[model samples]
Target: MSVVVAVKPSARKRNAKVGRLVAAEGTRHAFGSRAAAERWAESLSTGDGHVWIAAAHPADDDDVDCYLVSRATNAKLEAAYDKRRRRLRGGEGGKQQSLGGAE
Candidate 1:
């Protein structure tokens, strides 16, 4: 599932949030699963722990770009994943992109 979610307010607004922590800098993050996305969001908001963003599998990023996301976004998004997944599978909410590390 090549799902992308903003780890921060800016990323969410811009709709470009996804990728591994190593490349999440200015760039947004894309996750492989809702669980992973939620996990990262939780870590970024709650802990002083490091957060990991989802990057294109073969990581084309050169520097670490991950950022901490807000907790509010995480909880709301948990249900959103299910809805979006439906849309993605039905090809209604997306274009030619894959939703979960598929394409």
Candidate 2:
């Protein structure tokens, strides 16, 4: 089943969250019209579970071939990040540091 979802103009908050998950997976993403993005997003379902992101097909010739970052992946990444932040902070009131640091 192919479906299209319009892209809602995303702000830094939305984009930033997605970026990290795709990065964790060592993949690339495309940005463009929402309908295209949604189509790609919906294709990630597998027997195990839904994939978090579906990258644009390389065969695309359009000036802008949209890519999709799965909502599932986005949520997991955000949850993991939040947990790491809490762990690093060790307690409330301290500034959370980056996990990507010199590790």
Candidate 3:
């Protein structure tokens, strides 16, 4: 079976309720191998968002088991972005300093 990769955005509600991600319409791409699908998914995950991958027919979107793929660098990038945003909003932009003396 061919592997399918697509950027499926979260369908979670804004009120902090649980929700599943909805697949993008007409955005799925089929790859011949898992490695190739992973590569493409990783490429699409350069930012804070995640990409979804599943092994099944490209036409079948709902029944296959899906997994998320995110780049390792996304955590660091998201941290920096949050820090910058906080700084812009008049919050501490760096790590908190401990007030206690070293033992």
Candidate 4:
């Protein structure tokens, strides 16, 4: 069992790009970009579930190449970042005051 994720342009937005995640069993999912989809797929692959593979085959008329990333790795990185951010904020997401220093 394996999953396939690909990045391509969006159908509704001319300037937007979308990613598609398709399982070998025919289940499909979509994401904002190839990186996002591959990240998700990588997470799934880390578990005891299906293996996730990223397909970067170029389109017939395109000259760009796709890439892949690990979801577990991304998750770890995000967790570390969030931890640092919380420390910087003293564990409280306080509201910002106006530049004039008045509430």
Clashes of each: 23, 1, 0, 0
Residue-wise C-alpha lDDT for candidate 2, range 44-92, written one tens digit per residue? 3333333333334668553334434333346688888887787677845
TM-scores, one per candidate: 0.31, 0.23, 0.35, 0.28
> Which ten contiguous residues of candidate 4 have the minimum total lDDT?
11-20
Winning candidate number (TM-score): 3
* Predicted model with the maximum lDDT: 1
When sorted by TM-score, best at the front, the candidate numbers are 3, 1, 4, 2
Against the hidden true structure, what lDDT does model 1 obtain?
0.49
> lDDT of all the models against the reference?
0.49, 0.44, 0.48, 0.44
lDDT of 4 by residue, 1-103 (tens): 2333433222112111112232232234546666676576456544232334356555644333342332233457888888778867877654555789999
Residue-level lDDT of model 3, residues 9-80, one tens digit each, is 331221111122233234345668778767755555454245545454557656433443323244578898
lDDT of 4 at 76: 70
Q: Write one digit per residue (lDDT tens) for candidate 1, span 1-40.
A: 5556545443343232332342546444566776776686
Candidate 1, poorest ten consecutive residues by summed lDDT:
13-22
